[model samples]
Target chain A: MIKWVDVYKAFGEKKVLDGFTLDVHEGEAVVIIGYSGAGKSVAIKHVVGLLEPDRGTVEVDDNDVPTLPRKELYELRAHIGYVFQFAALFDSMTIGDNVAMGLRKRGEMSESDIAHRVAEALELVDLPDVQHQYPAELSGGMRKRVGIARAVALRPKYILYDEPTTGLDPVTSAVIDELMIRMREKLGVTSVVITHDMRSAYRVGSRIAMLYDGRVRQVGTVEEIQHTKDPIVRQFIEGRATLEGDAASLAAPGPAFESGATARGGGAE
Target chain B: MNVIEATGRWVRFRVEEAGRAGRFLEEAALAFGSVRSWLPNATLQMRRLGVDSLPIGLLIAVFTGIVLALLASYSFTGAVPLYFVGTLVEKTITLELAPVLTGLALAGRVGANIAAELGTMRVTEQVDALETLAYDPDSYLVVPRVVAGTIMFPLIVGVAMIVGLGAGWLASIGLLHLSSDEFLKGARMFFSTFDVEYGLVKAGSFGFAVTLIGCYKGLRARGGAEGVGNAATQAVVYSAVMILVLDAFWAMTWLHGRS
Candidate 1:
């Protein structure tokens, strides 16, 4: 399980996360939906110790992520897979090498075994016969699939996806949605995904959480989020412009999502 | 008050940058413990940064040699003997020009290459991906480039010196109408082993500083393409400045009493 407790992070007078809290249980997919710059990515980065919180603790399993020693943190990271928003493939390396990089770092597998695993991961993502190709040679969607393949090849217990379908076409988005579902079904891997794509959220998420004013405003099953009465959640999920009296409120920027917002049983999961 | 505020901000920024660089250096030094992780990568970096840079180094050396020979002949027309052309060319090339010029040239090429490549990787999140894979990016990315630069700078400078001397010898014979024996005699007259040692030390220091600054700027690059471009520019500029500084440092430290 991954737990972020009352995390408060700020950068030069701009607070990105304010009392932000969430938890991911095993064997389920939790999708975080929010506006741009709402600290969705920042919240997820805390899980991998990429960003340390100013006044909170991020726990992976029972281990405190922020306080873990360097060797321990690296050991903890080995069990988690993180898929970047941009695929983040190594431009200089071949697709096969990118997929095999993590396994090679562990230095426990034989060369043939690593090759076999790389090929298997690529096959799982439906990318075959492209191992020799560089990332720059691949299409954006294909590069994303390779990114997924790279993460899945590690067989990590948890996978974190950062805007997995942000830039892809609708058909490509559906393909990725299916891949996320397949990973859950086949490997039973726990996942935490950040996306603004409502269709993707409804499809892949077992539970959905909406972030507002740097904190989760509502979190529930898909049905609860879809039928939410909260005007902020409704405006966001329906892709509306602004809430009632929101234009003036946005100018002054007071506390947001405070009224008519339901935290649904007062729990993140 | 406004001027004071701006000056304070600039000073704070430089202090923060110095702190970051110090931390990065400490981490890089720690990464040297993992020899297996960086050795192969260092070998690849050496070939890419050093061997492949030979043509440009030689090209700069050739032109510099010809210019030095011509200038020496022009200056030594009257009371000064023509053989001093070879002596001047030899001393200048070996003691100063070969290391400083070659360093500045490679600083532009090697420093910019390291910065641009690593900056692209940073902006694209490849470095983050490396971390996710449980790899220390300092060991994998920084150590190899720095190792390559430190080991190869002196070697490239040595080769450039030889090529430069040969070019000067040819120019003295062809353009200055001086005998080969006179040129060789003048060249050997004022030569000292310390000159060559000082030049190589400067070259090695240049190599280390250039690549270190490149890696420092590159890894810290944020945003997108513009950030990468800025990092590359800073890498080259800082490297050139650092080379000149190190040159003066070595000259004072090594040549203070002897001269």
Candidate 2:
């Protein structure tokens, strides 16, 4: 289980996360959807021990992630897999070498075992033939697949995906979504996917959380989220938040009353 | 007044940068509590920073040796007694060529590669990924490069010195018709172990300067493609300039020590 308790993050003067809390139950696949700076990325970072909260605790399996000792923390992280937005493939190494990197760090795996596991991970991602190719030689989609292979190669119990489908075509997006679903079903992995694509969220999310203004606006099952009567949730899900008087009010700047008047004016009749 | 303030600001900045570097290493130690893993990371990074760099470093080493020989022979022709031959040759390579050429060669090779890799990782958010994974990016990234530069630099300079000596010997004996024994004897008298040590120390320091600057610039890189290009260029240019300034300071200090 992963839990965020009243997390607060600020960079200089800008508050990126403010007293946010969300719990992802064991075996749950939660997809976080939000605007770019809405702090969805920051929120997941807390889950995996990336960024600690200023005044809150991030617990992974009831153990405080941020406060864990270095040795304990690295051990805890060994069970988690993170895929970067750009795939974050080591450009200098061959595909097999990149896949073997994390395992090699653990310092117990034999060369043959590393090779066998890398091959298996790549096979799971449908990229078995790309083991020898460098990242520069592969297409973007292929590179992301290799990234996924590397992440899964570690056999992590928890997998965190940061914008896995961004910049990918719809077909590629669907492929990744299926892979995400398949991993949870096959490996029983607890997954957290942070993305802005509502379609992806709907496809992979058992529980969908929408982050707004550095807080989780709502977290629920896909059916509950889609059919909810909440205006903010509806506006966001439909990609028509621009029509909200709230959005207009926020986007426009002035004294509160004048901005309210403009927001009201801008709203659809 | 502004100029004085600016100069003061520059000095203060260097001091702060040094302090930050110290703190960064301390945090890195905390992050990498396992000395076992840390050593391997350093070794893997060292191999990449050194062995991978050998081919390119050797190319510069060879050419730099040949150039020193050629230039000195040309300029010193008929102007000085032949007994001065080894003194000039030894001083040129030991004091200047070994260290300068090593830095120059790496500015084009290791420095550029470090900037490019770090810059790309920065842009792609890989370093951020490492941090998110609870790994200190500086430890995983910069420490290895620093170690490689510090260790491999001396080795690289040694190669440059040997090649330079051989090339100078050939140019003097084979090309310039100088007596082989006199040229060889001049070298034996003027070449001291201390000179080589001085050159090696200079190489190590220069290596640290270039790698840190390259890694720092790269780790902080933003914007996009143009940003990375700018970073690579700045790393090379600044490292080269710092190498000269540091070389001059070392020279004055060494000269003082001898006197």
The collision pairs in model 1 are: none
Q: What is the TM-score of chain B in candidate 1?
A: 0.98
How high is each candidate's interface RMSD, in Å? 0.5, 2.3
For candidate 2, write residues A83-110 as lDDT tens digits: 8788988787899998888888777799
List lDDT for all candidates, in order.
0.91, 0.79
* Top-lDDT candidate index: 1
Which TM-score value belongs to model 2? 0.83
Give native contacts recovered, as a fraction, per prediction.
Answer: 0.84, 0.41
Specify the CAPRI tier of model 1: high
For model 2, the stretches where C-alpha displacement exceeds 4 angstroms are A244-269, B1-19, B27-80, B130-139, B174-176, B252-255
